[model samples]
Target: MSVAAVLEKDYFTDYSILLDPYEYFDAMRAIGPVCEMPATGALLVTGFKEAVEVLRNNVDFSSINSTVGAGVPLPFEPNGSDISEQLEQHRDFYVGGDLVVTFDDGRHRALRSIANKLFTPSRLKQNQEYIHQLAKTMVQQAVMQGGCDLVNDIATPFVTLVIADLLGVPAEDREKFREVIDNAPPPGNLDQSDAPTENSPLVFMGTYFFQYLMDRKSSPKADVLTELAQATYPDGSEADLLDMVKLATFMFGAGQDTSAKLLSNAMKYIVDIPGLQAQLRADPKLIGNFLEEVLRLEGSTKATTRVARKDTQIGERKVSAGTRVLVALAAANRDPMRWPKPNTFILNRPKIAEHVAFGRGVHTCVGAPLARTEVRIILEHFLAATREIGLCESNHGSANARKFNYEASFIIRGLSELFITLAAN
Candidate 1:
C-alpha cells in the first residue's frame, strides 16, 4: 500500500503526540515502514530497517539540504563553500548553529574524522574518572539538600561540566561557563519556535564561543580548542578557524543537551520502576545493560531530518528528490520486527547494544562515547552513594499523581524536572 493511503492523519505537528508518543508511533509503524506527514510534507520512516537504510545511504538521503538555517526563510542563501560566509548566514538565521550536525559535504567528513580522534580511549578513560569524581560531588551536594530536582541539580550540571571539560575551558573559568549556561534558557527549548530572534540564549552562547575560540587561538593552551586550532583537514590543507570554532560551539551545547536528556531518562526509569533501583544498587555491573535498555526504550533523540538527493524508495514509499524525511530512531528502536517484546525493558537483551541511540553510519554522533561515560559514571556514583532513591512526593507528588512532566519537544525525550531524594548509605 502507498504510504499516503496507509496513513491518513498528520502526525508531525500534533502536539498531543509529544505527551505520549509511543502508542501513536506504534500505530504509525503498523501502517507500514514509511508514512507521509501531510502537514510538513515529509516522510516519516518508523521501521528499523528502513531507518537504517536512510541513515546509511547518506549519498541518496543527503543531510546537506537540512543546514543550520533550515525551514525559516532567510535573505542570504545558506549555500556556499566559504566557512565564514556560512557562519554569517547561520548567525543571521539562528545563533550557535554549527555544521557538525548539518553539513554532509567533504569538509564535514574531514571534520568528523579529525574530531573522532579527540575521544580516544585514553581521553575517554580520563574523562570517565573525572566524571565519576564530579558525579560523586554532585550526588553528595544533592543528598545534603535532602531532596533536589535531579534534572536541574544533577544531570544538567553534570552534563554541562563534562562539556566544559571537553571544550577545554580553563579550570578557573569553569564556573564562569556554568554561569553562562545557567543564565541561558535550556537548549532545544526554541527548536520548534518560528524563528530565532536576535536576543535568544543561542546567540549569547554563539558570541561567547566566538570569543573563546579567539582566546584559545591567542594563548595556544593545552586544551581541545588549542588542538583544533593547530589541526588540519584530511587533505593537506589547514582547517579554517571558524570551522573549528563552529564545530566546538556545536559540540559544547548540543552535547550537554542530549547527554543530560539521556541521563535524565535513564534516572527516571531507575527511580520510577519497582525493584529496579535496588537491583542496580546490588549489582552495579548491570548499569551498562540498564543504560542500553533505556536507550532502546527512551532514547535521547526522537528523530532526525534528512532530504532526498534523488528519487528513491524508502521501504515501499517512493520519495522524490528534495523530499524531506524524518527518521524516527525512537520508533525504530522499538520496532517489533527488530526487537522481540520491544516495549519491555529487558536488562540483558542480547541485541540491546545494537540500538541506534547514537545513530548509525557516518553521521553517527561522535560524542556517544563521552555521553556513555558520563551516564555510566554518574549512575555508578549515584547508586554507590545512595542506598535507596525515590521520587520526592512533596515536590513531584506520587508517581501516579500528575506531578511529573516531560519536555514537549519533537526531537528530545527527557524530563523537564525530576525531583528525587537519595538516601545516603
Candidate 2:
C-alpha cells in the first residue's frame, strides 16, 4: 500500500536496486500502470501502454527534467495548470537542459536535423566496411590474449572508434578522445558523485569540437564536420555555433556509452545461455533478432524523465502541472500485458522491434541505427573468430554462484567489467 512497503528502498540512490532492477520494476507495476511515488511526487509509468502515452504526448509533457528525473527540485513552485513558462525561465538551472535531449518542439526538431546528417543511410553504408574491419581487428587482439575484459578491451574501444570514425574525428586524436572519456566518470556512476563538475567530459569535448567546427566554417573541407558546420535549419537559416558544438559533443558522448553498455549486456546472455553462442555462430542471420531480444531484456537506459507542462492524464492517473514523470522504458519492455512471459527470454519473439529500448515518439534516440550496426558487426566478428566463448571463472565465479558488478547508476544499466575467455577457431 505504501511506497516503502512496495519498493523497500530508494530507487534513485540505493545500490542494490541498481544491480537488479527487474524485481523492483515488477513491484512498481503491481501497484498500478501509472503509480505515483509519494516520496518524490513523480509518477512512474511502468505499463507498456501508459509509457507509450507519456512518450508520445510531448505537448503536455516536456523533457526539461529528463537527465535529472525527480532527483532535483524545481526552481520555482507550481502555481497553476501550466508551468511551461516557469520551466523556460529557469531552464538553464536544470541539469542537461541545454543539451539536445532536453530540447522541445521547434528547437528540438531543428537541432535533431543537423545531428541526423551524420547518421544518414548513405553515411552508415560508407562506414559499414570500417565498422566490420575495426570489429574484426579488435576481437582478434582479444582472442590473441585468450581472455580479456570485454567491457574495456572490446566493447568500449570498439564503439568509441566506430563513433570517432563516423563523426570524422581525426585519427591522430581518436586515442585522446578515448582517454578523456574513459578517465571521466560515467554519467551517473554511484561511487563518485553524479553531479557534473568542472572536469566533466562535455566541457573538454565541447572545446575540441568548437575549435573543429570553427575551422571548418573558415576553411571548408570534405568531411562530416564541414557539412555539419554548414547545415541549416528546416527554414534554411543558419544554426548557432554553440548549439552545433553541443549537439556534436552530446552525440559523441551518448553514442559510445550506450552502445558499449549494450554490447556488454548482450554478451552476458550469450555466455550464460547454453548453446546460444553455437546457435548464433552456425546461423549468423539470427544475430539481429538475438540483439533485439537483448535490447528488450537488458536495455542500457532504465528510465527517462519528463515534466508535466500542464495538467494531464496518463492512463487514468491525473498528473498535475510540474509533476515529474519517470518513463520506465525497461519496465515497459517487459510488461506482461505487452509481452507474454516477459521475464523469460525467447528467441525470435514476434514483433520484437516494438520494444522501447531506444524509446519512441519525436524524442526517440537519434543514434538508434548507429548503435544497432556497431553491436551487430562486433558480435558477428566475435562469433566468427572464436570456437568457444565463456565467462572467466576468476572474475565471475562458476555458473551456479556467479557474481558480477553492475555500474552504480539509476539511469544506465550495464556490467562494470565482463571478463571473458575466447577459444579461437
Candidate 3:
C-alpha cells in the first residue's frame, strides 16, 4: 500500500496502527526523521538519531502535560472530537506545573524525589521473590493449555497482576483490570475521547487504593504502596487523594500493557528462530544479552512526546517554545549509526543497555531496573524449560516483520494479542 493510504487507516486509529506497525513505521522513517505532521502541525520525530537527540536535550524539551496540547502532537490519531472539553479535564494535572513526564529542573527533581522512594533498591529487592514466582506461575498457566497466545496468556496476567499487587488492588479487582484491556474498544472506529477514560473500573481501583494511602500517611508501611500513599508535593505539602489516584492510575497505566507486549514480541521472534532459542536455552547465561537484543529491536514504549521549553535548535530545526516533538524510541533503538546493521536482531549486540527503550532525561522511566529484571527472569525460566519453541503451522507468516499490532494508543507500543503454539520438552 502507498504511504498516504496507510497513514489514514493505521495512523488515524489505534487498532489499525497495531495491525501492521513495521510497514507504517518504515514508511514514516523514510520521510526523514523530523517531518511535520500535516494534520496536527507538529513534528513526528521518527529517525533513530533525531529521537535520541530530542530525548537527551532535557533543557530544550520537557515531558510536562502542559506540552500535550496542539503544540505537542500525540503519535496516533486525534480522537478528541471535542478538543475543548478534553483540554478542560487535562488542565487539572497540567496545572500542577509539572508531573513526572512534563516538568523540568527543580520541579522535575522534586516530583522524581517523591517517586524514588518506591524504587529504592531495598524495596525492589523485597519484591524479587514475588517477581520470580509471578513469572513462573504465569508461564505455567500458558504451558498448561498446550498451545497459547503468549501475550494474553502469559504476559498480561503476569504484568497486570504485578501492577495490581503493587497498587493494592483487591485480588477481586484484578480480573476487572484485565478485563479493561480485554474489552476496551480499540480506537479503530471509536472516537478517541470515547476511549475509556481512567474513570471506569480503574477509577474505582484508584479511589479504593487512595484511601489505603491516606490510612498509611503517618504510620508508613514498608511497602511501595504505602510510600506512594505518603509521597509529598514539590512544596512541603503531602499528596492528596486525587494525587494518589493519579499516582495509582499512572502505576499500571504507564506500563503493564507495554511490558506484556515486550515479552510477547521477544518470545515471538526468539521462538521462531530455533537457533537463537537453542543458544539461549543451552547458556541461560545469555538471558540478559538476549533481553537487551529484544529491547533494542522490539521496544515496548515506541515513542514519547515533549514540548519545546523555548524556541531552540533540536539538531537543526528551530522549534518554538510550545512546539511538540515526538521522540520515536522504537526508531532510535535501531538507528544504524548507533547499532551495527540496525535492522537485524543480533542476540549478542555489544553494550545493548545503551538502547533508550526506557528513555532518558529527568523523565526517564523509573521502572527500568525492575522491568529489565522481570523480563530477564521470565526469559531465563522460560528458555530453561523449553527445548525448542516455534510458531505453529497455523501462525507462520512473514506478517510479523511487515505487520504487527502494537498498542494503538498514542502513549505506548505493545501487541494487542500474540498467538503461539509452544512445544514443551
What TM-score against the true fold does each predicted structure earn?
0.87, 0.96, 0.82
State each model's CA lDDT, in order: 0.73, 0.86, 0.64
Off by over 4 Å in 2: 1-4, 191-199
lDDT of model 2, residue 158: 88
Q: Provide the clash count, candidate 1.
A: 0
Clashes of 3: 6
Instruction: Please provide, for model 2 over 1-425, each residue's C-alpha lDDT reduced to its tens digit, 9 standing for 90 to 100.
Output: 34466655667777767777888888888889888766566788999999999999999999988876665568889889988888888988876789989988888999988887778888888999999999988899999999899998888888888988887788887788889988876665555433522236787888999988999999987777888788899899998889988888888888998899999999999999999999999999999999999999999989888999899999988889988888889999999999999998899999999999999998888899999888999999999999999999989999998999987777788888999999999
Model 3 clash pairs? 18-405, 48-332, 63-101, 63-102, 64-102, 407-414
Candidate No. with top TM-score: 2
lDDT score at residue 412, model 2, on the 0-100 scale: 84
lDDT value, candidate 1, whole model: 0.73
Q: Please, what are the lDDT tens digits per residue for candidate 3 over residues 13-119?
A: 44555554555666676766677666556677767667777877877665654223323343333232223233223445442222355556675576677776666
What tens digits encode model 1's per-residue C-alpha lDDT throughout 39-106? 55567788999989998886666564333212333334324322334433444344333566766657
Judging by lDDT against the true structure, name the best candidate.
Answer: 2
Model 1 weakest lDDT span, ten residues long: 65-74
lDDT, candidate 3, equals 0.64
RMSD each, Å = 4.5, 1.8, 5.2
TM-score of 2: 0.96
